[model samples]
Target: MNFHLLRLASMALIVGTLAACSTAPVSTVDPSPIPELLPHGARAGQPAVTAAPATFAKSRWLPVTWSEVPGFDSDTLHEAWNAWLKNCERPTPAFAGLCSEVRRLSIANGDEQRAWMQAKLQPYRVEASNGNADGLLTAYYEPQLDAARQQGNGYNVPLYRLPAGFGTRKPWYSRQQIDTLPEAQAALAGRAIAWLRDPVDALVLHIQGSGRLRLVEPNGQVRLVRVAYAGTNDQPYKSVGRWLLDQNLVRDATWPGISAWIAANPARVNEMLWSNPRYVFFREEPLEGLDAQFGPKGALGVALTPGRSIAVDRQSIPYGTPVWLSTPGPTVALNRMVFAQDTGSAILGAVRADYFTGWGQEAGDIAGRLKQNLRLWAFWPRHLTPGSASN
Candidate 1:
């Protein structure tokens, strides 16, 4: 077994058991109310929701290295991925249809990844960071290159684009940077290697679910890859309790008893059982008696307002710090938002974030399209601390 799995399993069993016993349910409502946005220019309508006073406390900014994080071990991470996959449900007709397409593509060729992204995904026009016009969304459809081989193979992909000067330094990557700087070369090359080895795994856990990889052909042909996509799923624990109570599966259906019944379910044989929709997907964060909403694209785009979102993390990372994201997989670009407004279940951590693509079939299409690496680097007020709260 992967060492990480063993550790996480050991830890989770304890947490899971206790989680089943907790008196209070997890709160879904944003602890702090969503602040109303001031009109971009002037507005004739009444003022939008007023901004809440910043709740984040001051802390020294620390560069938390993701690769060094113990829980990020590949095998353990793989367990989580496989778990999510096995319990994956189509949140909408478009997503469900996309899943069918992905399954179909999977059947024709053993390459499930490519089938989902190419034949299955809906395409959109996009612009490169350099203002070059291109496909808005590019889905990577090939295996990643080994680290050592990436230096010689320049095949690369694009993920997402951020406003220029978004990070701490200006011109984050100069035109001649890759060829001129050894560090940049190593970083870029290391990225290529990581993606080729385990594109999906690398992207989801380590890279903030974003990044670019190279798909080099023996014939020396290369193409751009994109992996920005998302799908909806249940917040199992909360959902399970609600489901059971709603269906009269249990009496009272409180967190403790409901959780115990869930854990005790004969089918939950491994730690991966957490992925079961009964416990994973939630209608809301705190188990509010509300049904989860499905927007046209998905929740991320709704929360972030993609084109209109901005940074705002007062406690952990500063509100304006520019960030650089690195994920595992082939993508249209490298580097995306460190603090996008959109959010969801799987996306909850001080160091974690979600990039909204759109909703419904569009969102489902985007979710199906993802398979890459993502890295983040904060720009404004470079001197900020990481926070404890992740939501």
Candidate 2:
């Protein structure tokens, strides 16, 4: 049995408020731990922390040393990336540039691949582009798991796990490893440099917690997305979590124990937890008025993922810039992108953004009620348009 399944089974039988079911919250240890990907001690609790999309910071921009780029020759991983690209459709503007490059490198030998990589690096040989590429990219932060007994709004909310019977090899790449590989370093460094030095264009959005979503595709198809916020409301690894911990909202001192308590409670997870005031999620498809998903699960695909969507703002920002969102949370600063274009449902004017809240009741609740102002910055590649000049 999978690890989460065992917990789920035990939780299914429980019935009561989360607070009623657990003993007095225990103090946790290690008080704060470094996040999985970000720099050590970089968390959300501090106010006036250096602002991000950091696309303009020279300090974060580093040169890509030659040794840092990876060798694509005789490398299975490189070949796999090429293979994946072959399956994706072409002629779309997004892949046109990469597609051409792929074709040239497809039949090249080791020596040829090296030469090609060098040539590719010739034009704007620099490290880190911030986070902008021609296409788009989004960051998905795995939320903190709770293990306590305090039931509230998110009670009975269904938490979706990686589907059963699906096994795929997990790939782990260390920052050090990437730094040692020239090509990989160059590419990532280029993007990171791009993000850090440029203004944002696209802002892809995703949220943690349970809610319904509505995706209105270009072809007029609507899909549903849902997630359940069954754990404590505090966004761990964020400034919010730190504050909540200080405020006693996070009574459990340890992450593991806290998570165990949440799993045990199986109800009203969101009510007692810290939340993002800037974001308002829905219970069902906003358009359809459906019920929210129950239990401790969520669907990022259907809930936060947008469908064939594009956004545009003519005044304050330009078109075609990729945005890395540092959401209204405490922990991780880099979120997803919301593309920039010339059209949308409710998005209009400068500094205005319309996030694709997915489809359905949950979507309705979140999108319909969201009218408050939120802080967000843009990112772009310095090459495409210098960050300072663009902003």
> Highest TM-score: which candidate?
2
Query: What do the candidate models score in CA lDDT, each in turn?
Result: 0.27, 0.27
Please give the lDDT score at residue 132 for candidate 1: 28
Error of 1 at 167 (Å): 44
Ten-residue stretch with the least lDDT total in model 2: 193-202
| Model 1: how far residue 377 lies from native, Å | 0.9
lDDT (C-alpha) at residue 192 in model 1:
33
What's the true lDDT of residue 141 in model 1? 14
Using all chains and alpha carbons, the TM-scores for the candidates as numbered come to: 0.24, 0.29
* TM-score of predicted structure 2: 0.29
**Candidate 2 local lDDT, 1-391, one digit each (tens):** 1011111111101111110001100121111221222231233452222222322322122222222222222232232223223222222233234456656666766567555544432111111234321221111111112211112323222222222221331222222233245643443331210011100000001132332333333354655443333222111212223333555644543333344655664463343232222121113222233222111222111112231112333343333333222233221122332333222222333334443333333332333233333222343332233234332
Q: Candidate 1 residues 1-391, lDDT tens each?
A: 1001111111111222211001101121112211222222123443322221122342222222222211122121221122112212322222332345434443343234422332322211111233222111112111122222233333232122232223444334432343356764454442332223332222221112222233344555554332233211112222333445555555644334645665566463222222222210001111112111111112222222221222222333333222333333342232322223233333322343333332223332333334333333332211211221122
